[model samples]
Target: MALDEAALETLGLGTMWVRRGAPSGQGVVEDEPALEEPRAAAYETASPAARPAAVQSVEAKPVAREPESQSVSAAPTESAPGDTPVRPVPPETAKTIRIAPAPEPEPLDEPAWDDFEPVPPVGFDPAPASAPAARSADIAALDWEALEARVSNCERCRLCEKRTNTVFGVGDRAGDWMLIGEGPGENEDKQGEPFVGQAGKLLDSMLRALSLARGENVYIANVVKCRPPGNRNPEPDEVAQCEPYLQRQVALVKPKLIIALGRVAAQNLLKTDASISSLRGRVHRYEDVPVIVTYHPAYLLRSLPDKAKAWVDLCLAYDTYRQAIPNDKARS
Candidate 1:
């Protein structure tokens, strides 16, 4: 119990006392006089040299006690020995505070894959493969005739009316590396081939640099067959209509590596709108084949500086091709 002022002064210390009582059977208490107040001695001021005496007060208050009865109550009653005190209606101490949960974050709205468009870097070329024979064998098994037939009668979109011929792809059908361009240009539309014209020559030279041939180790195609008048990007509807033909070719030929030659091809095939800089220098998957995206040959023809980057993509494609079909037996 806390020490009263009288008890503290009498003890000359901060000490407190817990009153004790004998058992009910042993001894009974009779009415007694009030406790006498301790005498307070004078006001002796402390000198700088003499410090106040050390006092250690008991920090804890009294523990719970048993109940007791009283004749009359003036102030709040305290428990005597062997009696529990009526717990003072516990002081309304502030209750523990709690913080509410944060509101759920709003969900983001990302564009769908089909809606994305891939844009290739100005300067870059895809790599060539080593095993042209194995690659060609795989492609030969697929029906290019069926693919052409499908494209020939394709009236899936309005472009069918404007198209001269169904530019049904060109180059090595059996090639290990497939070159996919955006769509046909004037020359390609007229010739029913992909990458014909000055750009095609440059592309051929690029293939030759890596010891590749046009109709030998490399195959070329585009996302759309018809030229989008004045060489504009093909419309979504046009690409949507023509895509099945390309998909069938890819499935039949099963090229070990697919080199998306431009933003349009990369965007359409990879289903991503990220720029070529972001897509380059990394390996991507197209169905079961490894795909290395790079700039279009036309773009490379326009910007000579990008040749080095194109070389990098080419090297990457070659490395991936090697990894895909390790040996002759693996192709079987």
Candidate 2:
């Protein structure tokens, strides 16, 4: 509670009493002076030197307060035991002032965390498992005669539009040894059979060295039956279209062992993009059949130094082919 003006004056501190003198009687307040002058005058002539002699001579102590209802007003009162003098209120000092009740405190703006419902922790789904691709259904169903017929009359790709002839594979149909090349060349396109002209003769000589012969236990075929224009390597789409025919050929021959005669042949036959250098000198599996990669006769002709390596590849193929044969006792 703030000190009353009379209590402050008793304490020797200046009082900010608004009245010019104490209010004298009921309805008898003095005329208002300028508000600024009254506020300024409230502090005047009230410095340390001007303090009342009675207050300055005595030690200060807290004054005891009466209850609000029994508080003294502006009349002089006798001092009680250990009690300081207090002024009494003027008669019926304007009926006790009543303060209004304070308004209820406004609610806080932010919401409490406890007010919200619990949320579930988030989770993620696992990725789908990868699987090997399924082989072509239509191609798998074709037989020797049906496969050959399909390949011959096939206009399945752009190769068909400019094809001189579809070299629908040659050599032994029931051969145990199969060799595959990339596609037809100039002579093979004209002849309607694979391995003709110089490359064919060289292939024949190589077979003779291995004690094998064309149309004996050996079958010669190609990945693409039709020649690519100017003997450029077959485009990916061309190879895709022609792959079904080659797949059918592999199914029909059921060779004891197969040989891939060039980079393109090895890559397409193996269904891989690995280089010939990485693929050669090993027996790799083409589903059930074992395959060996070798330099193509045309390639060997150009790269004559590799002919010795080709012979080594042929030896590996021969060993692989022999291993595929059952033991004599097992066979018996």
Q: How do the predictions measure up, each by TM-score?
A: 0.55, 0.58
Model 2 TM: 0.58
Number of the top lDDT candidate: 2
Write the residue-wise lDDT of candidate 2 on 210-239 in tens digits. Answer: 899999999999889999999999988888
TM-score of 1: 0.55
- RMSD each, Å: 17.9, 15.6
What's the distance in Å from true for residue 220, model 2? 0.7
How many collisions per candidate? 13, 5
Off by over 4 Å in 1: 1-142, 327-332
| Cα displacement (Å) at residue 68, model 2 | 50
- The per-residue C-alpha lDDT of model 2 at residue 26 equals 18
Positional deviation of 32 in candidate 1, in angstroms? 99
